[model samples]
Target: MIVGRRWGDAVDSWVKKMQSLVGYRTFTVLTIVITGLLLFLLLINGVRPEKYDIQEFHLSTETIRSIKTVEDPVKTEEERQRAASEVSSVYQFSEEIGENRAAIVTSVIDYVLEEKAESVESLAPMEEQVSDLKENLNVLETDGEGIRFTDGALVSLLLLENESLINLRDSLTASIRDIMSKPIRSEQVANTKNEIERRIRGNLEIPESVLPTAVLIGRYSINENETLNEELTQARIEQARASIEPTRILQGQVIVQEGQIIDREVYRQLKLLGMLTNQSSMKPILGLILFISLCMWLLHMQMTKWRASKEERQRTLLVVMLILIMSVIGMKLISLVSNNFDVSIAFLFPTALAPMLVRSLINERFAVLMAFLTAAIAGIVFQEGYSVVLQMEIALYLLFGGLAGLYVIQGAEKRSHLLQTSLSVAVVNFVFMAFYLLMTQSDYGVSELLFYGIAAITSGLLSGALTIGMLPFFESAFGLISTMKLIELSNPNHPLLKKILTETPGTYHHSVMVANLADAACESIGADGLLARVGCYYHDIGKTKRPGFFIENQMSHANPHDSLPPETSRDIILSHGSDGAKLLQKHKMPKEIIDIAEQHHGTSLLKYFYYKAKEEGQSVNEEDYRYAGPKPQKKETAIISIADSVEAAVRSMKHPTAEKIQEIVHSIIKDRLHDGQFDECDLTLKELKTVERVLCETLNGIFHSRIEYPQ
Candidate 1:
């Protein structure tokens, strides 16, 4: 409960902070988010489910396609209707129909037999006998209590012996009872009666003329025994309807062909899909605004991870914003053209190109953030429609491609190394495509594979080509010093380098040696080794201004410092740092290079000069002998300071063995540490120890493998 309360309090605090934001901070954030919204808005229009303008009977000018799969209600209803039509009606049977019909037939037979005993005592001719029996049975045919037979049938019965008449009665009665015992619907009544008559007549127990009388009597007595079951019949219809499968309209299915009339059913489908829009839709636009806001927040979090000044952060934001806008514009072009082809054009998008450009222009650390941001955008811009929240394949492939390109571009210090980035991104994209294929239970045709392959390769090549073309423009426009720029400046023929070589070759040699040492030490401590190496090359360029006054260029063994006052020599040495900074600034060198040229010495005392004046019995101030210092402000500059001091101190030793080199290296590093040369920078005591260990090892390698590095 306490933790929860604390969390709530923190959230409230954050909300308050956000509400209180003002001025430049608010402006910067607003600018980035609004710019992102405008860029991505171009993409959302194409990705949203295609809306149409039509009504129930309007004709369509173009083919209208479904952007997603949904159930087709009209087709589903037709299927259910077909299923219901096949269901037969149900009927209920009565259990007592058989006994009722049998009893009626028996009573008529008894009446006939009784009449035969009472009324017909004497024999008669056959015609008269048939006429008499027909008259007697006419009484049996009376309302609801009748057995009707023709004259031929009565004659056959009257002429039969007494035993045959009894047999006929039993047989007809049994047949009627059996036929009514099982289920029989009202529709089957006539067929049942005929079947009973056939059964009696086929037996041949009596003469053929007698057969007709038996068959007619049995046929007249049978009745309907079953009625229709309305409830059960309706239930069967429902069950059959439930068994049918619903039809679907798959994504990309054409609702109406080009130039076809928009029928009622198709219009309903379009309305159901939310495509028949008359008014403008603001939902996707609102959603895009929220999406871009979230992206800006993520970028802010990444920027916070790097501790930079407000100006630097603002600059980075604009750079990232420019790159993202370009990326979206690229995606928009691809989306527009994708409609012209059968295959998706998403694979041709150079999502990885953004990361490569950032990596080439900015430091690799910031490029990591760009990769994630680019991938997140791909998740949106490449989605199938507005309803699909994300497309995992395209998003993940972008992520993999961006990261692969970034990793490969890390070794790129020259323009030629960018080709490796193309190959790396292409390989990752292809592998991810194959992985998606194997994972999905779907098949791809040969033509589809060919299109996909071309798209992937095009994406890779585009990344490399765009990066190469954009780097020089960005560097010139932004005044940024990337590794490639730093490497270019380090070449021997550059004007500044040539000046030092021609005028002060001794200092040139010294600068090169310092470059090797600083590069090795900076790399060991995870500093910017390349920047340090390049900075070392130019740190002593000011020595060209007054060559002989500095001891390294005095080939005649003449000491200009000995002829001059201690203060004059101190002034000359101090002026070199500031003078070098001016030369670099005039040449429009990057600020980092100028900062290294200026801050490498810091404001430490020249104890030799300070003591020499005191020993000469002249009053001296320590500040006058010290270099004017705005100390080292970064890791590379700080390392260059240490490397510069140690390189000069160690080179003065007579027998520079492993132990002597360690002693002098440790002494100089400790002197710089105690004198507060590293105060302004964020280098820790532990990191300084690492620097100390690395320098000792590097110096030993330069001095012929003589010793131990600091443990």
Candidate 2:
């Protein structure tokens, strides 16, 4: 037993010595730097393109080839556009061309008829009428492609006199209007003119000379009336070419012959494949380093915003860095397996494991940040020179899965909760994966979908199992006091707590009241109430070693301290702080609880024993009656000290009132302040006043008067 005790002490001392050497700031900076370098190394190989320094070397394999068949997008688009532009232009027919020409021919005939009528009324000779009519119709001579009439046709018309010329004019106007009303192509103008002249000769009995001249005028007046419809024509062309398929180059095809020079086509294929080797440069490497550095810098800034203590921030960084490294390594291993077995096996990787662990064990924001970081790292670690689209999809899958895991474990408070959280995560994973597959419209067989579904489900369950198995190790290794661990320690069934309850019932009852007082007071001051409550439960555990000597456990009227010397009693009373700490240490309690036990009394004077010795004419040093302490180093421990004093002092009073409780609480705080017991802690004067008020209220409630029952 003695050897085991010494061994435990030695181990604890060694741990403390090692802990003292670790500088929080140095550890944080070093861990971040290491994490950045590791990320840069992992990602550089994937991000940096392979270059071939083929100074004189010939092609080894059939020049380079793309792993997957892909369309030459630029070439395909150009071909489609060229095909669309090849459609012929469309034209719209206009009717105004036929109408205006028919009107011009009627006007010339009307002018000739009017001149003849005037000559006849004046009783002029037929020759004079003919000459006058010819002179009046001469205006039509210069009109080409309009209403030009030849001299012979005019003379033939004058010979016909009034009736014949009028009939010819009506027939000519009707022929020109009917023929020119329909759409006329430029190439079909002659055929249309011939058809109109044929119609005039067959359907009407006009003179042949008049007929030929009328046909000439009709043909000349009828022009092509169709005009280009640009919008409609272009739309038709685009619709015709919209179904063109992209041209593609299949995988493993020869890009270039072995002995052929590296042309642009071959160079493009090699660059696309990323298979060229032996040529290295620093540009990609530097860019990768910069990217990793930026990520780490942003993570650091986020940590600063959290405002965690120096030591806590260091531990958090260390934990996150270690988890990220492990995640990256796991991804690389999984990728290797995927490369060897099935390429789809990479989807089975539980990228959420680390983030879930972080969420349960550390801060939620830290878990979320780590989720994003792990996703980025996994992208590089698992990439296999696939298309950019595929790479991005893989990264997004990991990111969503990690974030889902975090969301599941957001408010998890127990180990068993992880299993249920895992189920929720699995649901999220499957939903997201299904959405992704549908969104990308990737063709998949039933077996492929099933396989992906299984992988997604397995990721969640596996992550939860890993978190459950690993959390205890992390808690023990890092000396972390998680809420789960605190809950376990707070159980009344705990060995140390049960010992105090059974062996020192008075002290136990007193401790419970102190817990109430400390919990309320600490909460009011924004200190750790749970920690203070649990600390109070074990604060006076040393009193169990000598229950009869402490007044609280003395149920009988007789006092044990009456027979004991003041020096002896003082020694016993003062030793409880140290003794309680030792007992807690033997039970391997958390250091926080031990500190509360050891420092609650501080070095405050044992007033009763000191005054007793002084009244006896003994030259006792005042320091000799005080408990040994290193003082409270935190607000929780310091508040526990004040509550411990106030509880005991108030309980000793006969029928304590609210005003008396307030007075005693203030007195205890004042004495501690004057004695410098609070000097080592970060508790402020305002917090102390708040603590006093909370204690007064709590104590008043505990010792308040109750109504008498009717007997």
Candidate 3:
């Protein structure tokens, strides 16, 4: 943003060369388009745009905030995993497995009791009976998951009483039925065997030694009755996954803090949000382009009212672009500061500066347009995040402030008037802020109110100060003839005016009288009276080169024209127009004043010397003695041309009565009309007659006859 002086000059020169090559309107359109592009870039950068790149588990070096609300997919997925883990795997309770296990246990118990009855009925030896029982216990491997027992445990079971055997069977059958009623996965088989063993030991009224035989019968009969249903377990998992809600990442949320490690979860979220991709969305760019195009279109329509010359149009457009670019940048800077600090200080933005400057340097319509422009841009720069329609609160307040400045800055033609206008703008700003706060239902204490009031006052005073400071620079740079510059040029103490007064007294007096007549005549014709008066003061500045050579400045009665050739005298008379133009240019006077000085005589012939050459029998051409002129191109210069000659010719009249003054004024206009001098300027016939009548009246007043007192 800080451009070097040499670089600035190079760019200025390049722009001027381009303007000359392309012409005014084409170059101005290009400038406006370029300005719109710049605004788009500035606004898009401010509109909640953030991106970052970070590897998983790496420490983040910067803090990042989200500009939109979206689901954190990574966290949501983690929650689903947890919910699924918390859900128990579903299993089926198989009634067929329970019935088979119960039948197996009853069959084993019947075999044990049959073994004891056979041993007692046969009166068999204890060893033979135990051996027979061990053989009998191995019924088949097909009963359940096939049962087995040790030889010692088979002997104890063969010795058990029948009553104890019946009790053991009942307890074992009931415990197995109750346990198999609930679902269980494959991992619970060993624990189920232990539960059956404990129940058999508690229910049997048998010897402790025979308890192992009874427990073995019960424990070995139980098998895996609850098998996992694959389809039903999968359904449960899916239900848990669906139950987890996605985690929402809200707008303005800080996704990462400095020095925080980007773990796998955070990394996934960043990827989902497009932060790590470094690829910005095309929506913001496309939207900004369309919006900016519309803004430039409005500007093109508004610029139709800028009434000026081609060069002035180019100059004013350049100034307008500068003011706009600077104003937007100022607003952007304020937005950045306020947003960063989280302060509610938007009222401090100096939104009125552009409108005041535009109104002062150009027309009020352009100022009004600029006010809307700044306000709309404020809407963009001050928005908290990306939105279809930006916040209108700040935009509306800015609009009122800018319009207030434009409305009151018209009275600020003088520096003293600027303070009064500033006061009015400040009051408007305060009232608007007050209305805005009340409308939005903002709660505030006295200190907060004071902050708002001070900021409002600052916005207004700053606008006025900046306008006054920059006006002179703009006028000088653009070669604009602003009213303040015109007033400064009209001062009697100006160096050019003093030079005319001191060096050529008679010409000075003549110029002043001519200025009065021209001023009065210009007023009557609806021309610039001030411009004509100022032009008359310096119209004859070239006479200072050789003051005595002209009749007005001649001290002695002896005519210098008597000795000099008529051609030489004619050359001296004709040289003042060009010389004055050159001198005024040297002093860097405005183009309008310089044009008046050069174009006033408008190629009218010096008849005195032309006829004198013919009388002396010297060969001469009539066109050769005429003043070199582009002619009067404006109304003020044409009126000054008539008044200049009118004052000079009538001053030579003897007994200058009102009748004679009117006759001479009429004669001067008739001569110029016949000579085609007023042909170029768009002065209507009625306006010329009015000029004629007003000049006569003014001359009559200056040269009125007075009654001499008898002494």
Candidate 4:
């Protein structure tokens, strides 16, 4: 049957190879084609030239309008021509009259009084005469051409003058009064006064002469009206020209016929569209390179600190990638939903979820690192309209989420415990949100608060659930031994412990006593009592293989030590530690527990057997009788070693009491200290004292008056 089977297997192998040749070739060709297509697509989209276009627009030169430049001086002929043009368009000045007539009369009176006297005191005696003069002047009137005095005194005085003098005085007074009454009719008043004066001059025999040229003032010129469209076009042209060049130019330089086809309109449009030619393209490229390098460096640093197995590293990498992708997707969805639907939907992607899951499943340090990384990534991906609140929410959630996982799961057990942890995280998240809202005085309604609460709770719970669900896979794949697993193994009824109890009852009882002592000492020193207790349970497991050969497992009928030589007995006792470690490894026990079993003795001397051999006159090296050990590597392991020795020593004491037990425990600790058992661990003198006190108290309780009672 074996020969026939071998022959048939060889034939089948040849037939299968021939059949797979075509399939293998097809698979190889398909893989190459897919790879080539993917490369082509990457090349097309990843490397393409940018385009630039120019557009035409009108331009106005502001420099031409405001720039001061040297020019040839104007000649006398040019000045004469300009003056003639100005004189052609000039208008005679008009004086406003009516209301100011009293002011002019007052001014004339003041001028006559000032010319006659310097001060009011010199003119005081002529007050009555001045009053009479004022009354006569007030009665004067201009009837179209000449003055008419209603006062008889002025008329008689004027008639008594040489008839010509009378006429001249009347004409002058009439012209002055008319001009004062109608100052706006300056041309009419001047012409009438001149004709009257000319007539008077002829009658008086004075020479006729043209009046000196009158001082003429011209009115202001009016500007032409411009349409709105023309003004707007001019403004646009000026703006375009102003934007095209720098404002200031160097001295001694002149701009002659500046180029106007630079297409400022196209440049402005490109700037608005973020496609300007002046911008550095390398900026984004540098940023991308820096960001990717930083991310890779951070990833490498995190993996190094984690020191995880290859499988564990891969799994963590996958989970982190998934988280990053999911976070990006969630941010995109939030933007879409909030923009198109409602803003309340954005509350769903709470930053707390990522850190919570990471901390619960991974270590605390890694969780915190991931939290920071996630927050930074979320800030970049989830930014909406430059809102700092969103970034703050991400940072706060990551911080509290990591803290929640670290605090709640420090020594946690069941999956349900993570739910409790989630509740704690939710409370923290809600408080943070509420505080933020209150501080900013936001107009968030009760519904918004409710949404935040629901989001926080749901996120925390989901994170915890995911963490718990992933723990088993991570543990198995990475060969991780958690604190919870250690606690379970420490149970009295564990299969290994049960086997020790059934096969070697004495060793089992000794281990239990050691566990009690070690737990008390470790707890007092702030060490891990659970690790110490669990280590004690399996510390003497090797005694089970050869039960009768060891003193702890030897029954009353057997006296193997009496029959065996001192060297042989010491060998048997020392070999048990190494044997126990091997058995644990065979059964796939954790390395930590195996370490405790191997290092409990730590090469300590077997004094009794060594002395016994010396007394028997047998030459034996003391090193040959010592137990082989790698020594305790931690405080808990060192404490357990001492406790193991202390427990067995105190058990052999006669009539032990609280005081006696205290003395014995202290002695054992002191001896272990002197032996340098704590050299490898971080235990200090203060912690050692606390351990001694706890041991004394626990030992006193165990050996109390009640325990000494007989039935």
- Per-residue lDDT value at 610 in model 1: 90
Report the CA-based lDDT of candidate 1 relative to the real structure: 0.78
Query: Model 2: per-residue lDDT, tens digit, 168-234?
Result: 7788788887777788887878788778767777855676657676666556656676777889998
* lDDT for each candidate structure: 0.78, 0.76, 0.79, 0.58
Q: Give per-residue CA lDDT, model 3, range 221-323, as digits (tens).
A: 6678777778988899999899788888876678779899988767766767666656568876787788788877877776765444565566677778889
Candidate 4 wrongly placed segments (more than 4 Å): 1-373, 381-402, 419-458, 473-479, 707-711
lDDT comparison, 2 vs 4, better candidate = 2
Worst window of 10 by summed lDDT in candidate 4: 212-221
Q: How does model 2 fare in lDDT?
A: 0.76
| Candidate 3 error regions (>4 Å) | 1-16, 46-291, 294-307, 386-393, 520-528, 555-558, 654-711
In the range 286-336, model 4's lDDT, one tens digit per residue, is 543455446545755676565433334544554454454555556555655
Q: Cα deviation of 346 in candidate 3 (Å)?
A: 3.8
Off-target runs (Cα >4 Å) in candidate 2 are 1-30, 44-73, 76-83, 86-88, 117-150, 229-302, 343-352, 363-365, 368-465, 487-513, 519-530, 537-589, 597-635, 666-711
For each candidate, give its TM-score against the true structure.
0.70, 0.71, 0.62, 0.55
